[model samples]
Target: MIAIDINKRIGRGPGSFRLQVKTVFQFNSVTRILGPSGVGKSTLLKILAGFITPDSGLIKFGDAVWFDSQIKYSKMVQERNVGFVFQDYALFPNMTVAQHLHYGSDNADYINQLLELGELTSLKERLPRQLSGGQQQRLAILRALSTKPKLLLMDEPFAALDSALKIRIMERLKSLFEEQQTTVLMVTHQDQEWEHPKNQIFNLLSQED
Candidate 1:
């Protein structure tokens, strides 16, 4: 299981607040971190992903210790083997769809499966600029998944997609996650977006209590 126990302080301005979060995120299931804007959802995810360090407490994934403030030990983001998909679907403008997937892994079979899963088999040669917003989002997700990461961290992954496409992509992601049994931790402002029973939804507001 992926266990998290951390207290972080962010935003140097007067609006900043101490983001104290502690929770155990189970593996082999999707965990939705639901909250309103400015709730430090992304901050928490970043800490877990090793993009940022916690001021105190510890974080562990199964037998591995990702972070331990008391021990003064912290792993680098890349060393954590965590995949991240940002809100804007951070794709390289110069890279083709196939290139992005190849960056994740050299396995041709895995790349082909991801391309088929994202429905981008026809657009493999196209650059990010050539694809639609929804297509870009799918490609971004596929690239992350292709890495075969132990944990996937997503920040508002579907915020850029339209309603129809969001639903379709969500369905595909759910199916793929189940098939792969990859652990996912996603932050979303929309509460209804994670209505699927397979996912364990946890509101940050409730988590604070």
Candidate 2:
């Protein structure tokens, strides 16, 4: 289980608001985080992935204490073994699709499987700049899965793909996640129609709520 109680201040004055999150995320579940534009939805994922730190909080995942504000203890991003697919894709400009997956894991067979799964086998030799927006997004997701991370965090990961491709990828990913029992936290403004028994929704409401 992942339990957290975090608080962070965003912006200043009238435009500012406090993002206070207190919740427990069950294991081996897929959670879709929803909120208004600037409600700090992405910030929550960032904090969980150790990319950002909250002003005060206690983050515990099973036996691991990811953060403890009172003790000034916080885990580094690398130490968390999290796979993150940013909204921008965050791919290496010079690395080809194959190279990206290989960088995550040295297993040749596993890498090849991921390439096939993402339908990126033919584009294996293409670099980020050479691929289309949707292709780049696929490579990003594949690279994240290369390591079989315990926690997968995605920020608007499907925004680049069309409805058909988006649904197809999500379907494949759902089965893969179930097989690996990987916990996923995806940030999206709209809910995808696909549903799974382990799927969950985390709605971050306005401060007034």
TM-scores, all candidates, are 0.90, 0.95
lDDT (C-alpha, whole model) for all candidates: 0.83, 0.89
RMSD values, in order shown: 2.3, 1.5
Worst 10 residues of 1 by lDDT: 200-209
Model 2, residue 208: displacement in angstroms? 5.6
Which tens-of-lDDT digit does each residue in 147-197 have in candidate 1? 888789998787767887677777777777777778999987673766666
* lDDT accuracy of residue 30 in candidate 1: 87
**What is the per-residue lDDT of model 2 for residues 1-209, given as tens digits with 9 covering 90 to 100?**
99999998877777888899999888899889988888899889899999889999899988899999999999998999899998888899988899999899999999988888888899899989999999999999998899999999999888888988888888888889989989999998664564566678899987842
Q: Pick the candidate with the highest lDDT.
A: 2
Q: Pick by TM-score: which candidate is best?
A: 2
Model 2 lDDT, full chain set? 0.89
Off by over 4 Å in 1: 191-198, 206-209
